[model samples]
Target: MLQCGVAIAAMLTVAPSMALASADSAMLPRNLSPWGMFTHADVVVQTVMIGLALASLATWTVWLAKTVELRQATAQARERMAALEGGASLAELARDCGEASDAVARLVQAAAHEASLPGASWDSDFKERIALRLERVEAAMARRVGQGTGILATVGAVAPFVGLFGTVWGIMNAFIGISQAHTTNLAVVAPGIAEALLATALGLVAAIPAVVIYNHLARVITGYRALLGDASAQLLLLLSRSKGRPAVAFGRAG
Candidate 1:
């Protein structure tokens, strides 16, 4: 009988404590979704997240713009290269090319201008001059096409470290909160830890695509450069073959 009474007293003592804990649990915030954690994160962490998101946005934007530009440029260049194979003289080729502002068109115009110079005898030196003009145009066009790609390289190289900084800052804040709260409860610390990791995740998300895109763009640019080289070679061949022909051949397309 005494033992039963002692057990009842112990149960009575614990009942109210359990009820109070249940009340506190009900009052605590429960949703731990990513957005929820982000919304509740420290200001510095939030800034880091926002910056990373912007970087990712920039990466995709560049990818889209460069993709469109490369596709059009490659198509035009291929068409012009095919035109070079037709037995069209420089004058005829220029006329057929119309007033297109493409690099190859400028190349044809430069060769014609050099040929038309009164001093331009259809000699080795004349060919050299024509080659030089085409080279300059090629270089200029390549630079123009590659103008905005540097940012992708910059983002790829720096984004991870930026995220790391945010993660460190967030973890630091979490530790401070742990000190203030004087508890090792997972509930108290887990959200901050998760927020810190989210920053790192965002950084990787921004960086990886930037790197892949930069590399892909670089390869496409190289192929485009090769097309320019082939065009230059074909033009030089045409100039050389017409060397013995009448001055009229050089008249339009030296």
Candidate 2:
């Protein structure tokens, strides 16, 4: 009986020691793992990532919408100019192109209005005046075409550095935590580094699309500018040829 009692006492002592060791291991905080570090990262890093994602989506959406609009504008302007060059009257051209929102139509309308000005007879200088008016119309068209594209330029130029700032901030915090804990384990430093990298990746995700779309939209806007300039030149040539001639009245006998 004494031997059995001694055995029970010894087992009880061994079990408590094992439990204490397990509790200490658990209390060591899992070697300060990356997952634990990430849980403590600044909220601002997450906010920046969210913002970059939103910016990328917005830029791509705008790029798609603008491309379709510019393509349609170009095709319609081409068709309208071809009809005008085929000797269609201004009124007929306007009616045929009523559905078009191209810069060419605005120039044509401006010229028609100038021609209808009272006491402004068609003279040698009429073409010059009409050309000047067309220039103004072209400028307006350019402004319209370029609207909202500046946002892409701003975002592309700024997003990378913004991400870099987040990376730097995160790395600084990681180092500070390492210094405090006096540990170099992968678990201790990985989370902060991963959080930092996430910012840079998000920034690039936002910036690359912005840059690509900006370039594409710029080319489309350039093409529209060229089309408008060509249409204006053609209108001026027609005006020069019709100088000193009475304006042809449409839909009414003069």
Candidates' C-alpha lDDT: 0.85, 0.76
Clash list (residue pairs), candidate 1 = none
Tens-digit lDDT string for candidate 1 (1-254): 99999999999999986775565454334667878878878899999999999999999999999999999999998899889998788878777766677878778878887877776677668788988999998999899899889999999999999999999999999889778765656766777788899999999999999999999999999999999989989999998988965554334432
Runs in model 2 deviating more than 4 A are 1-40, 95-101, 249-254
Stretches of candidate 1 off by over 4 Å are 1-30, 246-254
Where is the poorest 10-residue window by lDDT in model 2?
23-32
lDDT of 2 at 20: 56
Score candidate 2 by lDDT.
0.76
Model 2, 1-254: lDDT tens digits are: 99999999999999976775554444344333445534556777766677777888888888877888888888877876797688766656555555445788878777776766665667777777878889999999899878889989988999998888878887887788668655665655676677777788778888988998899899888988998888988887777777667875432211
State the local distance difference test value for candidate 1.
0.85
TM per candidate = 0.87, 0.79
TM-score, structure 1 vs. true: 0.87
